[model samples]
Target: MIDLHLIGIGTGNPDHLTRAAIAAMNAADLILLPRKGDAKSDLIDLRRTICADVLTGATRVVEFDLPERDTSAPYLGAVEQWHDAIAAVWRGKIAQHLPDGGRLALLVWGDPSLYDSTLRIADRLRADGLAMTVTVEPGVTSLQALTAAHAIPLNMVGAPVLITTGRRLRAGGWPAGVDTIAVMLDGDCAFQTLDAPGIEISWGAYLGMAHQALVAGALAEVAIEIIEARASLRERHGWIMDIYLLRRAVPVA
Candidate 1:
């Protein structure tokens, strides 16, 4: 049985690598890194830098082409197909490199359990009759980076926080029971669709990196500011990974 490790490397920050994640990387017989093409080559470079900085052993580092989901298909369906393709790639790599079961590691952008499909793809291998054991080394998430960049608490005192995607927020609007919302995977400023007048937004782009940009103010006031910031950052960097926090501004008594 192959022992697999999914190590999370937080938001492109080399310092965000936990001791356990470093240990996992050094311990692996093979480490797989994915390339997402030229537009976002920085992501690929970041993973390479992390590997160079951390691996002390002879762990073989391998690079793989990440499969892009077909946009024409429905979102969920495309994602499912994409995961299957990624799993196929993984199976090929393991078979070619380690025909005999051994320790393997893959660096995930963030904690695999949160909004990542690495674990889900790993399951496909098991279903395909490959004997394997999986372990996860959690790392800092974008949500953490977002809050840290903004210097704000993730949640208000004793209040719930709804962590969701741009699509859901655009479709559902502000959910009930929680004034605090952490929006992730939001390509479009979904908050623009909200009727939230008294809401406040703290937005960050390229978080945890040198070119980090942040904008914060009342939602109605800075909504366009964030939109423009996001567009400009994407153009400058060729890619942007951003997240934002929203809450109803507390009225002074």
Candidate 2:
């Protein structure tokens, strides 16, 4: 049986790795790294750096080319297809590298339970009859990084906080009954779709990394600034992962 460990590495910063994460990496017999093409080479490089920093044994490392998801297809269907392809790749890699059973690990970006699909993909492996047990090591999420960077609390006094994606915020607008919202995977800066008034935003890009950037202000004032900055950063780095928190001003009783 292959013991699969999905270890969260936390926003590409080696310093953010937890003790459990380090132990799992060292205990693994093989670690698989996924390369998402030239544009995102830096992401894979970060994983490699984490491994180099923590690994202290004869653990083997392997890199595989990740299959690209089709953007033109319907989002759900496309994601399902992509996950299947990825699971196939993982199956092949594990079979090739570990014909007999062994321990394997994947360094997940941020915490896997948040917005990541690694667990779902691992489920696919189990469905395929792969004899493997899974273990998870939690690490800091981008949400935590964003809040810590801005020195702000995630929620207001006794208030609820909604964590969502850029697509949902754009499609549904601000969720009712919640003053705070944390948005992720927002390539389009979906905050622009909101009414903007009475909303404060704390935005951070490349959080916990060397090239981190932060911006905060009334949404009306900084919306355009954020759009421009995001575009410029993506142009310079060829990719960017950012998260932002928005809080609508609560009226005085």
Candidate 3:
């Protein structure tokens, strides 16, 4: 049986790695890292750096070519096919590296439970009738990183926080009953669609990395500024992973 460990390395910062994560990596027989391309090479590099810094044993490190998701197809359909293709790659890697059942580890960005599909891909292996065990070691999420970087609480006292994406926020605006919203995977900066007055925004790009950038102010005032900064940052870095928190102004009692 293959013992697969999905360890969350936390937003590309080695410093964010937990003791349990380090222990899991060291205990694994093989660690798999996927290369996403030049623009996103920093991601794989961060995993490598983490391995180099913490892995102190004969644990083998393997690099794999990541299959790009075909976006031409419908969103759900494309994601399904992409997950299947990734499962095939995982199968090949496992068979080639460990003909006999052995422990393997994959470093996931942020937390696997949040927005990431690594667990889903792992589940595909089970559907394919492969006998393997999956275990998750959670790490810091981008939501936590963004909030901590800004030194702000995730929500107001006794209030709720809605965690969503740029697409939903744009398509459905902000949800009711919650003044605080955390958005991820928002390449389009959906906050611009909000014409709501007195909305406050705390936006951060490349959170927890060396080139991290943060901007906060009233949404109406800094919406344009955020757009310009995001564009400039993406142009310079070639890729950007950003998240933002939105809060509607509440009147004083």
Candidate 4:
């Protein structure tokens, strides 16, 4: 049987790796790295850097070109098809390199339990009748990095926090009865669409990596600044990953 390990390496920082993540990487017989494209080659390079930093054994490392999702298709349908394609690629690579069934690992950015789909994709492998077992090693998440970078508590003194995506935020507006919201996977800067009056924001991009950017202030005052900075960073790097937190002003008791 093949033992598959989905190891979270955190946000592209070698130091973010946990002791358990390091041990898991060194123990694997094979590690699969997926290349998104030249524009995002830095992602794969970061993975390599992490491996170089922690691996101390004779584990084989392989790189494969990842399948691109068809943005033209419906979102859910496109994702399902893309996951199938990825599973096919994984099957080919595993059969070619480790036909005898051994421990294999895929380094995931951020915690897999978070907004990441590595876990969902892994489930596809099992559904396809691959005789494999799965294990996870959690690591630092972008949410943690964002909060730490801002030096703010996630929730205000026992207040509730809503973790959501950009699309939902744009579609549903600011959720009622919640003081805090953390947003991820927003390409359109959906916060711009909100009618927030007394809201404040703390935003971070490339958290835990060099060249990280941070901005915080009243949402009305700094919304434009954030949009400009995010655009410039994406233009310079060809890709960007960012997260933001919003809190409505709390009236004094």
**Which model scores highest in TM-score?**
2
* TM-score, per-candidate, Cα-based: 0.97, 0.99, 0.98, 0.98
Question: TM-score: which is higher, 1 or 4?
Answer: 4
Estimate every model's Cα lDDT from 0 to 1.
0.91, 0.95, 0.93, 0.94
lDDT of 1: 0.91
**Which has the higher lDDT value, candidate number 1 or candidate number 3?**
3
Model 3 residue 212 lDDT?
95
lDDT per residue, candidate 3, 1-253, as tens digits? 9999999989989999999999999999999999999998878888889999999999999999999999799988998999999999999999999989899999998999999999999999998898989999999999999999999999998889999999899999879999999999898999988975889999998889999999999998899999999999999988999999999988777
Model 2 misplaced stretches (Cα beyond 4 Å): none
User: For model 4, which pairs clash?
Assistant: none
True lDDT of residue 154, candidate 3 = 94
Q: What tens-digit string does per-residue lDDT give for candidate 1 at 1-253?
A: 8999999898888999999999999999999999999998999999999999998989999999999999899999999999999999999999999999899999998789888889999999999999999999999998898888888999988779998999999999888888899888988788989986889899988778899899998999999888998898899899999889999866555
Better of 1 and 2 by lDDT: 2
lDDT of 2 by residue, 216-243 (tens): 9999999999999999999999999999
How many steric clashes does model 4 contain? 0
Regions more than 4 Å wrong, model 4? none
Q: What is the lDDT of residue 132 in candidate 3?
A: 89
What's the ranking of the predictions by TM-score, best on top?
A: 2, 4, 3, 1
